[model samples]
Structure formats: C-alpha cells, structure tokens
Target: MATCAEEVSKTKLVVAAIDFGTTYSGYAFAFQKDYSSDHHSLRIYGIMSKNGCSQKAPTCVLFNPQGKFDSFGYDAENRYAELTLTNEHQDWYYFRRFKMMLYNNPNITWHSILKDDKGKSMNAIKVFSAIISYLRQETLRNINERVANVGIKENEINWVLTVPAIWSDQAKQFMREAAKKAGIHSDQLDIALEPEAASIYCKHISVSRRERQETHGAEGVGLEAMCPGTKYLVLDAGGGTIDITVQRVQENGTLHQVYMANGGDWGGTKVDEAYEAFLEELVGQNIWEAFKAKYMDSYIDIFREFETKKRTISPDIENRITFTVPPVLRDVYEEMKNSPLSTTQGHHRNRKLIWKGDRLRVDVTEAKKLFETTCALIVAHVERILDKEETAGTSDILMVGGFSESPMLSNAIKERFGHTKRVIIPEEAGLSVLKGAVLFGFDTRVVSLRVMKHTYGIQSSSLFRKNLDPDITKTMVKGKLYCEDRFSKHVKKGQSVRIDEETQTIDYHPLDDREEMAVKVYITDKYDPEYCDTELCSYIGQLLVCLPMDVPTSDRGVKVNMKFGGTELSVRATVMATNQTTHAEFRLLE
Candidate 1:
C-alpha cells in the first residue's frame, strides 16, 4: 500500500513556468500526460490575456498611495495612466519595465529596496511577492476554469521561475524568498535559467520546413539540421538583457552546455533609449521634458506604437518611416521653439525629420541607426562565443525572446554569420523562454550539464607559507600562523558540471569555544585566486552551522558539501561526531 507522501510525490500532474522578464512577464503550464507524448502531439497552454490569448503581458505593476499592489501587467499600465490623468499618480507607486535593476545591482540583498518610476522607494521583496502572488492566483483561476473535470490540487503542480544566467546568487535567492512569501513552497519550485529553458524548448519542438521557409526564406533550415551531438548557440534577446549560450544535443535527447553563458545590457530596450535620446536631441531637452510631463499618457502611447513598428523595420527598408506625434507634442514644440516646424535634418544629412499632417517622418536609414549599437554588440558577442576553442564545429544559431523577433536584428545576425552558420528563429520567438520554462519543470534532465559562471568557494585559513603567502593575509590564531582569507576553490569558472554533482567534502572545525561556525562564501571571476581580497572576488554570503556544546572541539568538526550543478548553489553541513546533517542557510552579505 502506498503511503500519503508516496502518493503525493507520484501525483505530479502539472508543470507551470513563470517567465518574469525585464520588460514583460507571464506564466505557462502543461499537463504531464501531454508533455510525455510526442513533441508534435504536446499542446502547451499560456495565460489567456485581454489582448487575445497571448503568452506574456507587460512587466508593469501599479500600487496605491498606501503602497498596496493595485494592478499588474497591461491593467497596471492603464490604471497608472488613469491616475496620472487625475494628478493622483504622484503619491502612488508605479513600476514599469523595472526587472533589470536586479541584473545591474552589484550588492543585492534581501533587504534591498527598489525605487518606482517617480523615485518612490518600497520594499523590493513586498513588491516582487505581490506580483508573484497575483500571477499565482490568476494561474490557479485559469486552471480551474479552463481544465474541466481535472480537480488538480496545489501539490500536484510544479512551479519553475526563470531568471537570467548572469544574475548573482543573491539576486536568485531574493527571488526564491519572494516566491515563498507568495505561498509556493521551496520543494515545489525550481529556478530555470532563461537561455537554458529556451534551448530545451527548441530542442523538443521540431520546427517544420514550411514554417522556416515563411520566415527565413528558402535558405532556412529547421531543427532537422541538428542531429545528435550537433552544437548550436542560443541567443535569448529580451527587453532588458541579452543572454547567449552554446549547447549540444545528447544521444538520449538532452542538452549539454558547451560554453558558459555570457551577455550584457544590450537588449531591445537599449534601442528604445537611443530613440528617446534622438527625440530629445531633435525636440530639445526642455521641450521634450515639458511634453512628457504634461502628456504622460500620450508619451506612453507613442512608444507602444513604436514597439509594434520596431519589429517590422527591416534592413532592406528604403522608405522614410513615419511616426504619429501627439498634437500636444507638436503644439509644445512650436510654443518652445517660437517658430513653425520645418523639414530639416538634425546632425546627419541622411537622417531628416519631416512632419506630414501631424506625423513625424524619419528616414529609414536614420531609424536603422538607432539599432546599430545594440545589434552590433549582439553580433560581436555571438562571434566571440563561436570563436572559442570549445565551440568549434558549431554551425547553427537559435535566436529566441521578444527582441529576437525584430527583423532588423535578425537581418543583422544573418548578414554577419549567414555564410558559415544557419540561423534558426523559431516561431513565436518571444514566448520561447516562457514555454521552455514549463518544459524544464516537467523534466529538468533535458539539460544534462551546465557550465559554472563563476568560481565559487569558501574563505578559510590555511597554513601560511613564508614566501608564497602575502604578509597582508597572514594572521595568528591560537599562537599558530595561518593565511587568513584564503579562497578554497570548489568549482572553477567555465568548468562543465553535471546536474546534481557534489563537490568534494571540505572539513571545518569550530573556532575556539564558539557554539556556531560561520563559513564565509566567496565567488570570483578568475579561475584561481590565492585570497578572497583579490580583485574581482566578492563575499556573497555565509553559512552558519551550530555545534553541540557537550562535544569536544576535535569531534565538533563538520563536513561541508556544495553542489553547483543546479542553477542555484546548495550547501549541506554534517557533523562528524553525531552524523547529523542539516541544510545551511546562506544569508547574503551586508
């Protein structure tokens, strides 16, 4: 007879993934039966949104004056704009497209506070927890309403949250804590890297030749080109950051990462910034600020339209592009400049600005310039990844994410690597991460191995060598000379680690008569470091283990185990004398 715990463990019927992107966020889920079927037979479902059944919604959140979450996604945008119209938004908190702050933060902690668009500060954990709770509630409601006759219990569903590969461990932990506050247990949650999830999703779904022809023309090759053991690059270009990784197909239909993930803030939002800068230069900063302050809603609408238009602009576009300027902006411009608008070029002759019946006409050449810096950086980074010694023989590139759908970016990559590599842009590139994350929750083994992004280790005291050890790191404990802050490396950067692989056991003893021992964890970008105080090395967190008071100091030693195969770091401490083991809580450094 099966026990209750056994039954519940075996009854995992659903896998849900939340793709919390920088500019957009959404959730997707799949039933176990459907996912286990043939790739062609599997039918993954996304959250049904107001603007049709879409995979994602805008990553926007609005709070009331009392700092309570009022709305999320597109609804939040509308609600904030409505409040702005009544001059009530000054006190209310409105955060839009703000997920990049985590990526850019150097010293993120659980107590970190985030600033709203208007510079109002709020507890980041509360803000993130509220957004996650809203998504969870909506997902549960959707499951009950859409899936008929399937009384799915909360325990039967597995949740996967997606994060960027370049994020620090502290950032990942912050998200984990936020999710727990949203009512999801740690056991039911899994952290999936954005690029890895997209790779798995693409590997399972076989893109048809006809679909490839429609997008990539006759030269387009689908997943059929990738046989077992074939290597390919995954470029996940989202709104805020671009993440690039290389993976190879395994014989059992899994993926193995060939190169460590690498990217930067060169995503689609950079282009938006460049466009705004161009507008500021053309309209003058004073007039632009006035227009924005007086017509905030109109400013948002113009960018909303640009979001759609941006995807259609191709490298081959020759005609002058036109953007409808709000009447207020035109009136403001005239009032500030004290003259009528004329067809004149600003700074560049090829880039001319003309007004045609309340519409701002820009040259296609100039519009393409806005994407030059970001697109070039993406292409250059991809080139460097392919040039690596480990990435040899890789001939296919898979582009995913919302920004990957841009024709300008797609054309740029194709033009650069078209001769040597076949670029495969899967259908609905924007939803790849969201759907791939769902597949990851179903079977994490799909990605067999991952490369360590940083060299992780513990700061410890070692026998000091007179010549090799620096005097600055020398310390005396109990009349014995030791090298303090010595970095004990467990995992090296760029080292390929299999899933769930544990590092060699490290022995630790309590210092003096203390009942607790603190293990300071440190990480560095360098492959090897002598001490934690070296450049590029940072103290991330510490794991504290309590020792039994009755036991002698010699018997109070504990064995520390670190596992780096998964996305987040896991540590366990086992007392040698009592043989008792407990998970270590790594509190982020202040």
Candidate 2:
C-alpha cells in the first residue's frame, strides 16, 4: 500500500473552499495562522434565502435573454420567480438541481449540454463555470470586505472544491475545468472528496464525545478522541448522492481508508422525487403537468416548501403534514379541469389528501411514505458496507451533509444500527462538508490513504493468443498477429494507495508509425478485466504521448507513470530517447 504524505503549497496564506452542492452551495475560508489555535477562525459565508440568511443558498443560476450571466443562488431564484410572474421567463434561463446532470450522466464531456427549467439547453461547462465564478467572486469579496484588512491576492489563496466521493473522474475533471474557466488556477486548486472532507471536519470535533459515550458506551468516543486504530464510517448524505466511506485513524493522526466510498442517487432529492410523484398521483397527471408549465413560480414555491418540511418531518409525528399550497395551483387546476382540485378523479378516491383553501394537508402516514424508499436505500447500503470484511471493526457511524439533518434519516439509522454502532449526527451537519473542505485545503494529507474503487488500466497492443484472444481483436503488426484493445492494468480494484504514490512505470512502444501515441485510459469494475471493449469496462480519457519523429518506429518508446491515489488520476510520460518528460492531460470531450 502506498503511504506517502501529501502537503499543500506553503506559499498559500489562506485556504478557501466551495461546497458546490446539488441542492445548496456555500463557501468557507480560514487563514493558515488561525488553523491550529482558533477553532472559530473558519468563516462560512451566509447567502440570502427565502427564510432569510443561511450558510448555503439553493444551488441555482440564471442567464438573461441575451445569453449573459444575471444572478445566482437565492437571488437568481427570486429574480426568475419574478420573471415567471410577468411571463418574461420564456427566454431567460434558470437552472436548479443541475448538479445531478453530472451524477446521472454516464458520458460527461466539456461540451456536454445542460437543460434549463423550460427545457432550453446550454453548454454544461458554461453553466457550471458561471456558478463557480459567482462563488469565487463572492468569496473573494467576503475575504476582502469582512475577513482581511488588505485585499488577498488570488494566487495567495488555496482554492478547494468538494465533490462526492462516489463521483467519476470525468465529473471531477469537469469541475476542475469549470473552476479554471471561473478563474481559479490549476496549481492553486484542490478537489476534496465530500465524505473525506466531512470525516476530517469530524475528526477535530470534541463536543460530540459525551453524546457518543452516553449513546453507545465508552467505546464510542468522539472522532476527535478516536484511538490510533479506531475505525468509523462516514455517511455523507447530500442532496444528490449518499456518499459513504469507512475510515481508520492512523497513529500519526492521519486517516486511512478502510473501504472505498460508495452510494447512489438515493438522497434528499429522492424524497422530493417521491413527493412530486405523489402530487401527480393526487392531481391528474395532465393537470399537474399543466400546473408546472403555466405556474412555474408556484411550482418552485411548492418545492421550496417541501425542502423545508423534509427536514422537520419525523416518523413519530401524529398530525397531518400541512403544506401551504399557493393559490395559483388551485386556480390553475380549476381553470384547466373546469372543476375544483378536490373533485379530481384521483383525489375523489383518496381521502388522505385534504384540500382546504390554499392549504394542502397530507396524512402524516403518506408524508412519511415519501421518505421510506430513500431512507431504506441509505440504511441498506450502510448495512452492506458494514458487513464487508474491511469495515468489520468500524463501530461509529458519523453522519454529515445537508440530508443527514433529516430526522427521518437520523432516526432510521439509529433504529437500525444503534444496538451495534454509535450513530453520530454532528451539529450543523450540513456545513460539515463546507467547513471540512477548508481544512483539507490547509492540509491535503489529512486523508493519508484511499482504496481504489475500480481497476484502472491502459489499452495497449499485445501478442495475440488463439484461445485467449478473440478473433475480432486480431490485427497484423509487422507480419506478427497482435491483439488490439488489451487492458494493461496499473492498479487493481480495492488496492490501497497514498496521495503521493505513483504506479510502477510501464514502458510502451508505438503500435503504428504515428508520431504521437494515444495512451488510452480505461477503468473496470472487474478486478482483472481482459479487453478494454468489454461490457464492464469504461473508457475514461486518453493522453497523447508525443514520440520523436527522428527515431524509427521500432526505437520509439514511452514510459508511462500513473497515479490514482488522489481524487483524480494523473499521468506522466517520459520519452526514452531524448529523456523529455510530459504530463498527460486526460481529455474527456475531444
């Protein structure tokens, strides 16, 4: 296992982190001097929400009709809502919950397109870049106006962006590209995995120790007090993804990965999806669709209300879940159906949905049902991770992220794992990622090790074997038969790796007389994949290895060195003849 320690650039005087979440987003920063002594040195920016000020505003952006950036966050939301009221939003682009585009997409490229609220499409990179740029400016403004006496130079600040641990390299790279477009230099930025950052933030928190001891006995010391070999699980349930990772504390006060992070799209947004489905069922699907189309402002309001209500909902609540239904919904429903919403076909059969002037009271049982599927998936996934051999010693469950604040989810986890492990929901669970990312920016080595989630390799030409290689992969190479698309694995799945460790150098020769070699990178779920074109294998990106044209094809060689220990994979290639070294830029889109 690779165990080299990693360090951030010492020239950086301050660390700033942007937690670009699916449902909400925020930024935090702390100076290097305040990192050790002052726990309250970290300053989290508060954005304006409908409820007033919050640590995070909704993750959203808006563009004017001229295709120029307008506003972001709650400001964008309020502006777009006003536009919708005046029927002026048709040409204006407003996007919300767009981070899911990266999660749901299998092929994310620089040119990937994102659709706005009205199904209008814009370049995905542009959309992401706009949000990141807004955050960057806001953070800099905060530091200049409130935190620092003198203006901080962009180069003097280390920028960190938090991504879900389960995200694909393409997604991570996409964020990097967006950050670059947003004016953050590649040398100054770091990608901190969501669960890993949360774990680091929890590591310094001592207030939860008493609660842990009282809840799960003496063995359940807080993460701050964890012994050298103590193992804990981090469940980062965000709006878009439930990222879970098992961590083991090392003797040096660093953390090692017990298991790779894993989870799915079953998050807080899943509950939103379920609620929308329920609404569609209660009101006729066509009517509901019409309502969303014509009453965009009201539709947004409904979900904003749902977002607030989702956090407070509990399994023990007896009273009905009262949602303040906007008057526009009722008006549109009656206008479209030529009758009151209560007399709808679906509502007539279900007495659980009570409609009273602008107030839609849903049975508590029904409201709780919306959470069942998502909560079940999260609970089951954690159970499966705990059952794994690598995580056998883990006895503490550290919950963090915006969705972890849900009482329903908190209760479900405790009810299931309380007897076996201590379930900890740290204070301000939502800000853990934002705050932890700032800490990660200060010290990249906080997470000293990580487990590989996939077997990573390069596609190369190999000597064809009659039985082992398929006939389709056979090709003539200098009168000798060779197999194309062979997987040359550098790192196997489940291998432990350190942040600074590089894979063993693998030398390769040009398959053809081409001047440059395409070092095609591939990843697979299988431990030992044979062919790069297999169903389980995915083509991630490729690096162009430039070979000296003066050298003969037979003499051309490049030594490939790959590093998969960090959040992103990096490649370095050294030419054999000139001894010239070049780094590979994994091009995702073309």
TM-score of each: 0.93, 0.93
Tens digits of per-residue lDDT, candidate 1, 163-237, equal 998788888887888888999777788888999988887876755454478556776574454578889899999
List per-prediction Cα lDDT, in the order shown: 0.81, 0.83
Candidate 2, superposed: residue stretches over 4 Å from native: 1-8, 36-50, 207-224, 343-348, 549-555, 577-580
Global Cα lDDT for candidate 2: 0.83
- Checking candidate 2 for backbone clashes, the offending pairs are none
Top lDDT model: 2
